[model samples]
Target: MQKLSNLIGLPVLETVTGTQIGMVEEVLLDIDQAVICGVLIDSENWFFKAYGIGFEDLFSIGRDAIMVRGSEVIKDLADLSALSSIYRLQDLTSKQIFTETGFLLGILMDVVFDVITGEIRAYQVSDSIITDLLYGRQTMPLPQAQVIGPDKVIVPDTMAKLLHAEQIL
Candidate 1:
């Protein structure tokens, strides 16, 4: 498992030529499906357009970098329809998370996902900055049902009872 936020700024490498194509700028996710759609690669050049690589096109996701089979897998974000409608990871942060019964739980902090399968396993949430600094963020398993709206995320009410606060040392 990997935290989606950690992927940001990691190099995107082309395996065939061992060239560094770009850095991971953002992770694109299908919120309703709770799966990563792909990533946006920053070419770091004003003359170049950023590219998108679907999760399926990745050769491997390593601790140090993300590898692609070759430059062929990289394409203009406009051309990658699978990522067209997805939300960037950064866009979800600070969005209020609520229970089905309308109880305010917290806000989205991060996502724990399977690096190999791109499946979202859990969500790290923060009630407030003070709570986060004292108890750390709470981690909750992906609920059976989730609704992502323009301004908030709603999960099953049972999630309120299941959230586990991370121990801060």
Candidate 2:
């Protein structure tokens, strides 16, 4: 699978028409499944203002080409809310994770997907020290954590306190 970091900042070009679509800004993952469902495109105008464009107006016409429906190209527009939700991220290996205290926990190992709901259930952490200490000779699933932002996943202080108190096992 392609890594998210590799795709980020990469220029999205149109193969058929040779028109440049835009660079990927952020990737939207299914909260329940942790799988990437769409990508957010950078649609700031030449003056660096966000132009709001709806997803319906942006269609993928070719492998690399994304065509806007109207006469105005994205670069000329100033509103950007609609363009923000149009692109979807296809990969998910480079998402970062951290502890509530701002400690580096680990990178995302994989996303658990729920078949019935078709969403991300939990995130898998790949830290060897934490995994070995917590599981201890048995395999256990990664702890279910909350995503606080696009770049931050936080285990609540209450949950962290519980885990520290040995109440969660």
Model 1 — TM-score against the truth? 0.86
The alpha-carbon RMSD values of the candidates against the true structure, listed in the order shown, are: 2.9, 9.7
Range of the 10 consecutive residues with the lowest summed lDDT in candidate 2: 160-169
**lDDT per residue, candidate 2, 27-82, as tens digits?**
45544434444445674443354432233344442233334544243342323323
Scored by TM-score, the top model is 1
* lDDT values for all models: 0.84, 0.43
| Model 1 stretches with alpha carbons more than 4 Å out | 44-50, 79-85, 166-169
Candidate 1 lDDT, tens digit per residue, 1-169?
A: 7788889999999988999988898988876687888998887554555478989999899989999989788777655434545788888777899998899999988888998899988888999899988888898898878877778999999999989976321
Question: By summed lDDT, which 10 consecutive residues of candidate 1 come out lowest?
Answer: 76-85
Q: What would you estimate as the lDDT of candidate 2?
A: 0.43
Best by lDDT: 1
What is the lDDT for 15 in model 1? Answer: 87
